[model samples]
Target: MTNISNAKIAILATNGFEKSELFEPRKQLMEAGAKVTIISLESGSIKSWDQKDWGESIGVDMIVDNASESDFDALVLPGGQMNPDILRAEDKAVDFVKAFFDAGKPIAAICHAPWLLIEADLVQDRNVTGYKSIKTDLINAGARFEDSEVVVDNGLITSRHPGDLDAFSAKIIEEVKEGIHKRMQKAA
Candidate 1:
């Protein structure tokens, strides 16, 4: 297991986030000793989307508007059709994502969460993967899209869907342990 005992991770999501995508990674990271915080568009709790219905509610640790990239070592974006679609439209949320990229911090986006990367304009020329529905959007954003369980490009890690959670969580732990990437620094 990768040890990240000193690392601080920020999970950005809102209502409609894929339940497993957010929970699994958060669970694994915490188990590995990382301090994980849920950052969202609002205070209080955000509901999850599980399969065809609403899932459990996850408490928000901090609002996006109040979050600072410097406060966390890495970022995680959980996907669900509604989650990313809604986040992509929030200017503060988009800017919050951009700040993480600008600081060259490691970012992990699973499934539809790549939409936020596209919104932040950080996918150009990078290799990434996401749920099938956003393949074109990722390609148009200049990302070399792949159909894989997980793809780690620089400090950005992405995966296809919930089934890829194991690989996705592993890669996130690996990257966070590796720290900032040179590619991200150059892009920043």
Candidate 2:
């Protein structure tokens, strides 16, 4: 196995991201010695959605339009109703997710974050799990949805909710240590 200290991971998000979904995994990954960058729609900070109200804000490390899949070892997408909903609508955000997928880089998406995967058309023919509310959407988008703490197909890792953050974050670190998955397929 490779060392996690050398890994560089990216967490993509925006306003309304689930506070715990983003913070927990980030904290775990960082504690494990990986370099994590928070990518967002803008350069400043992005607000998070906790349970019912707006939560904390995290500084953005790089804007989506300026980030490339090649710069990081893996990608993470945190979920919240508005975060993925808003990101999925942005061409730049969708393209960025698609690029990482095309490159076969490790990607861990949790809860509503799978919406971004669907927007990038990366869930088709894949096994995934996300927040219960988006299960039908995953099925409609051509994915075999699994109700589990975590589901990983190739390098794509997904989990249902914040409760699965431990598995989600661990899988991301493991995948990165293994390097890019040798997954081959037609473009999305």
Candidate 3:
């Protein structure tokens, strides 16, 4: 496993996030010694959406309105049908995501989370993958869509669904450890 002991990673999400997609990656990153912070739209706890029902509530460590990309080494976007949908519509959320890209920070997203990437206008000319339901949306946004478990383009890591959590987490850790990517730096 990659050691990201000094990396400050931010997991940005809101209520209705896919339970496994959020928790699993956070768990794995923390286990690998990375400092993982849950940055949400609010200050209180946010509920998770399990497979078919509401899941646990995770405390928000920071508010997106107050977060700065300079303070984090990487970002993780967990997906659920409602989570990304809600986040994509929030100007603050979309701007926060764009800052990470602007700074060339590594970003890992799964399932519908890429919707925010689309909202931030960061997917153009990039190779990415997400939940099958959003495949067309991704392609329409100019992203080279893939159906693989995990697709890494520059510093952007994307996966199809919760089932790809292992690979997603691993790639995030690896990318974070590798630091900034040249492509991302150029874009920035």
The lDDT per prediction is: 0.93, 0.91, 0.93
Candidate 2 lDDT (Cα, 0 to 1)? 0.91
The candidate with the higher lDDT, 1 or 2, is 1
Among residues 3 or more apart in sequence or in different chains, the pairs in candidate 2 whose N, CA or C atoms overlap within 3 Å are: none
TM-scores of all candidate predictions against the true structure: 0.96, 0.96, 0.96
Top candidate on lDDT is 1
Report the backbone clash tally of model 2: 0
The residue ranges of model 1 lying beyond 4 angstroms of the native Cα positions read: 184-188
Q: How do these models rank on lDDT, best leading?
A: 1, 3, 2
Give every collision pair in model 1: none
The alpha-carbon RMSD values of the candidates against the true structure, listed in the order shown, are: 1.5, 1.7, 1.7
Q: How well is each residue in 1-188 modelled by candidate 1, as lDDT tens digits?
A: 77889899999999999999999999999999999999999899999999999999999999998899999999999999999999999999999888888787899999999999999988998999999999999999899999999998889999999999999999999999888776633344
lDDT tens per residue, model 3, 1-188 = 66779789999999999999999999999999989999999999999999999999999999998899899999999999999999999999999898888777898989999999999998999999999999999999999999999999989999999889999999999889889776643255
Q: How many collisions between residues are there in candidate 1?
A: 0
RMSD of 2: 1.7
Off by over 4 Å in 2: 1-3
